[model samples]
Target: MSNPSSKPIGLEIDLLETQGGKVPLEYFHKLISQLQKNHSLDHLSASPASAGEFDVVYIILSKGTLYEETETNAYECIIIDGWSCWPAGFAYLLVPPNRRREKANISGGDNGPSDTADIKIALLPIAQTRGFGRFVIRTLLSHAFDALGIRRVTASILCPIQPSHSVAQKKQVGFNTKQLCWIFEKFGFKFEGISRGALMSMSVVEGEEPVWHDVHRMSMLITDYFQEKRSLSLSAMRSFSREFPLKVVQQSPWEIMIQRQEKEKHDVESWSKRPNDASANDACGNDGEASDDETVLGGDEISEK
Candidate 1:
């Protein structure tokens, strides 16, 4: 059933910031506290759409932050809007240093690990299906490929077998596993396989037996990112922008890459037409790798402007 109190609307994503593992203990508490008191999120704690249905939905639903540190190389990120500073959600990335070393030991370091990373996300109920999820994933993928230079990004989505229910009265609260799989596929992530018992139960009830759930593992390589970027049409881009309605205080790595590529292309064209102009040559001296920004914007026509 559609939420009576909620309406589907564009979300204005203002910021995506990451903090090191050394984040103060109190910061987590503050975030959790703010989320718990926000009445707009009460549904997520009690409704089927609650993140608790898939993962351990704490911090906002329960008493504690559900924060844990298993990997030393992981980083936590917060998403917010610049206008009202609304906390939309949280995400984390795990980048292991040993991956490169292990690959080097096996293959003489020529191809190495290619810098693989893993990401997980948790969004508030108020932010669900508002295109904030897409924005977050896009920004993260851009950061992984361009800023961190990661070659592959992986995500494990919970896809447990849900209990059978009456189909007639069934109300869709949020994206089911199948829909989520389709969404990720559209983003160029390939389905790897099912990971049986991939996650442990995070039930808050006392004396409850622990249960495990299966997850579908999916991955996207840097090559996949490039291919998707090239294939993305102007209409699709406009749709995404309209869905998210972003007013970013900090540009995502993807946006930065686009601007850089545009500047470099302009410089090269200027130098080509003015061979005698030393300034043009100097400006275009750097052999920067080209991006698919222009091609994506122009789509089939391929614009020069």
Candidate 2:
């Protein structure tokens, strides 16, 4: 709960940095080892810990912010021991090579530029309940939308069929599927659907076999991101400490506000250009739209976890 400014202490590292001799792979190994030892993250899906598994790695530092950029500073970031340069959490994005641009038919017509990517984030137990998650998410989404030109970002969260734990044990575990969904929704992600039997259970019960579990799918479009930015109050923006600079391309609070204003103007123009028939269908909910009952059923998927 500390981090009053909600500013993220982040360091960006390319997995290729190991091969380039910029940073050694052993540092990353230490990070993964410490992350695996944290029992609180058992409920979440395993991320790309190995060098070959992911393209980029964003390391969120602890206590203070990252200032200078040096090999020693980078090594300190990876050496997460919960004391000096503690890693609060990590996040990454997987972008397919030769990805084709696709239209995001959110408003019945061509809204704006659209592309897609997938994201994953995990935080240490000590970092939770603080503003670390918010900072990480804001940075990731900003990178995806602004730098990468990604219009839609998807997240598939693991939802266990039966979590092995008592009431007390449950308290120590990280956010469940429902809590994660709620948190993501707060960040403008919409519940897409659930993939049945998408992942094997990460929990282990003595003498019991691991069971297949579903994955909750959610997404945030560029429009949603704009809306989220517009809804935030100026005071909320000020709460973010600008002292801790992130290692990625992120918009400032004032920049976000300016972009929001521009986007609002663009939206009005786009709305005026939309075809009448598409608008009618949207109003009537006639284009294979989910009924209220079906929507309720989808919402119920997150009720358990």
Clash pairs, model 1 backbone? 1-171
lDDT string, candidate 2, 1-305, tens digits:
34322564443323335434233556655666666776434445555553133244566556443443443443245333334454555666765332322222123433434356777777767668766777767877887787767668887787644655676554533256678888889888999988888787755576887787778888999999888777675535555555454578888999999999999999999889956555644665646767676687885465664
TM-score of predicted model 1? 0.46
* Ten residues in sequence with the least summed lDDT for candidate 1: 53-62
lDDT of 2 at 87: 53
**Cα lDDT computed for each candidate against the true fold:** 0.54, 0.63
Task: Tell me, by TM-score, which candidate is best.
Answer: 2
* Candidate 1 structure quality by residue, lDDT tens digits, 28-99: 545545445543222121232222211211121111123335644222343322222334555545554544
The whole-model C-alpha lDDT of candidate 1 against the native structure comes to 0.54
